[model samples]
Target: MEALNLNVENTSSKKVTKLPPKISPKHKRINVLEEYKKRNDNKVALNLVVVGHVDAGKSTLMGHLLYLLGEVNEKTMKKYERDSSKIGKSSFAYAWILDETGEERARGITMDIAITKFETEHRRFTLLDAPGHRDFIPNMISGAAQADVAILVIDSTTGEFEAGFEANGQTKEHALLVRSLGVQQLVVAINKLDVVSWSQDRFNEIITKLSPFLNQAGFKKDKVIYIPCSGLTGENLLKRSQNILEWYSGPTLFQQIDKFEPPIRLLDKPFRLSVSDFFKGGISGMGGITVAGKIEAGTIQIGDDVLVIPGGEYGVIKGLEANDESSKWAAAGDSILMTLSGLDILQLKVGSILCSVSHPVPVTSYILAQIVVFDIKVPITKGFPVILHRQSLNEPAIITKLVTILDKSTGEIVKKNPRCLPKASSATVEIKLTNRPVPFETYKENKELGRIMLRKGGETIAAGIIINILSYNS
Candidate 1:
């Protein structure tokens, strides 16, 4: 009787209207290069990552610089001073600006990358204050991956310089990693020189010892600039302190930063954006989801249809923000916030790549890469389980094959199918991701998307560049 009643209701003359298939808006592709030409030339954006060994005064130096630059107000600084003094750590007041975490403040260490925006006379800068501790090297690598230039801070205290530059210290490792990641220009800030009474001999000695190692690590002597400054006293940061160094003549730290040449923007390529972070609700209480990351290649505009790789979810760009300012379009190298229309928060995650539906980044499980192994206790062997880091993505992977070991000094093949890749060695190897496919491109195609880092036991073991996509299994 119930089935008959339901059938009667279905058969009752309900004029059922057929709903039309939802047609997504068709977007006309804009000439990104033409758009770029219309922009003002006064502002140049550059991402600068600060790196050095543990307790090298990296955070304090940058934090102090920000304070002096007026990014941090006097009231906030006074508050930090009062709070730090209560704990008998008044010296850490400036460091507290960047090391905002309670644990970080208490321990007096920076454990994660602190990103902030500041402006110079001629350029706008995205400063990445990376951790200097050995345990946080992975975090440092993540920060360095997004930088166009780097600032290597060094402690100038008599014995401290030796402690951080010798074996097991991160100074050498940080230099090699950044250079391998394609950071061409570097500023070496010899910090805390005031501790040694601002002696020129100490400054010269530190420079002489580090210069050879830096050059061997692929830093051009001319491209590297060394500045002696006291982070605690703010000497030679914004301007040279009077009567401190009558013998020396050079630009201040701010001048060096302003001189950094910006990398050529990849505006003509296909649009690709790497999702470094994601959140549920956007700027307003609107239901739109927001994803923050840098545009790796090409350009994206509001209302453009985008394809999220690996998951293959589709979405439309509802809003766009370049460097925290709302905009109609964003081009490569601009760190942006994108409000997406159709994707659920669950469908998106860090390391996801957003690309145009017409031209999307390839998703692959197996890749061929050219790697340079850092100083390690054991050689990297086949089938060795390691953590693979690409941008913000971290996944388990295995070294599938060692194709060939290349000479460190020259590009010639040293040996074919080497049994193991030793420390300070270069090789072309195949890597297999253990979990899911990742968005990747060849190194020659996109530097930002092609770089990869390998870690094991919380230590960075190797750094590499993708040479080819060996397999694309979904």
Candidate 2:
């Protein structure tokens, strides 16, 4: 294992200004905070993840919205329509705009996260359309980790909503997952109401049934908004169905999107970017590998030197792109594609963290965490095998020790050395990553990097935050 190198010569408290001779001449010191502020004034950046159970029409809804906003032109949309019709999936025309893969189109379900960029009147959004099937929960969790706010789409047709919201469904799991990952604002879009003749009662009934569960899942009532719409007809999406549904006078889906407040960013902290996806850029005529992720903290610009943790590889930022436009710099809360130079691409992995060379995140194999057990069929016992998920990485782990059960509200100890952890319980436990050391931080240090999810047998058993690093490679 490679240890973090802290003796790299610059010995400064701030970001290092000295660059290697391999770096371009543009590598110089400037106040990145001032530049970020100027760009932020025009349009606040927000990451929006659309999640729900399978067949909720998530892709179609967002695809139509993109077309309405002119992100998808008529010429391209017409091709999708004609192709979908020939394949006997005419209703999936709009969905094809985001679900571009032949596999996804053939199966008629989104298998992975499809990312696209669009702008509202007051906000610029990087839309993450996550997979909704139970088998793709890991993919959904990756998308949710980067989202600042979420849209929970539900099928409002008679028996559809009940099937998704009841009996161990993805609807409940997705809602809990996003809230566990620290998403506060939610928009519950009640879709397919047009199938039921645009009935207002159906919309209210669905909301009434879902409110208590969402509240239990950690979403506040005041922060959750409900809207009624038809993804197929595009009614109540960008415009109101005034003549048919006279009951709803609330804002449309697009209006509610603009109303979501952007979360506070850690602009002055040390730079950190979690790697989600990477590919060879030389295929596109670019020279190096391109990495994509949302900046979790601080600011990074072209020519900045970054250290990839757990492997101790160094790379220089050769270029940056945000919202499909070339940018010189990007701050926290912006999802960007970074082209890196002077580093071997093999060292970059999905779970790797790129940080300031002088101040890198810790690499830990053991941690003490406070976890809340979710609704599960079986109790979690000592040495229980599980998959630990954090950000974009999931690795095999075990509950090495069951320390004590704590009160969820007061944080006071209820029992010491509990034999087993039951559903809906909170406890402090020791976990060991069996695979390798991973980049981690305490919740007090950074909220985004500290959250973890535990899953077993295709179901999420618990979610928690790391409180202490028991053992690490430094």
lDDT tens per residue, model 2, 1-474 = 001111112222223343433544566666789988888899988999999999999999999999888999999999999999999999999999899899999999999999988899999898999999999999999999999999999998878888888887789989989988989999999999889998888888898899998887777899999999989999988897569779988899999999999898988788988999998883236798889888999998888988887777788888888666788888898888899887788988998999988787888889888888999898999999999999899999999999989877677789999999999988889999998988887776677887899999999989988888886675
- TM-scores for all predictions: 0.92, 0.93
At residue 264, what lDDT does model 1 achieve?
A: 82
lDDT of 1 by residue, 176-237 (tens): 77887778899999999989988999999999999998887778889999999988999999
With a 3 Å backbone cut-off (N, CA, C), the pairs that clash in candidate 1 are: none
Off-target runs (Cα >4 Å) in candidate 1 are: 1-32
Estimate the TM-score for candidate 2: 0.93
Question: RMSD for each model, in Å, please?
Answer: 11.7, 5.2
- Best candidate (score: TM-score): 2
Clashes of 2: 0
**How much is 6 displaced in model 2, in angstroms?**
28
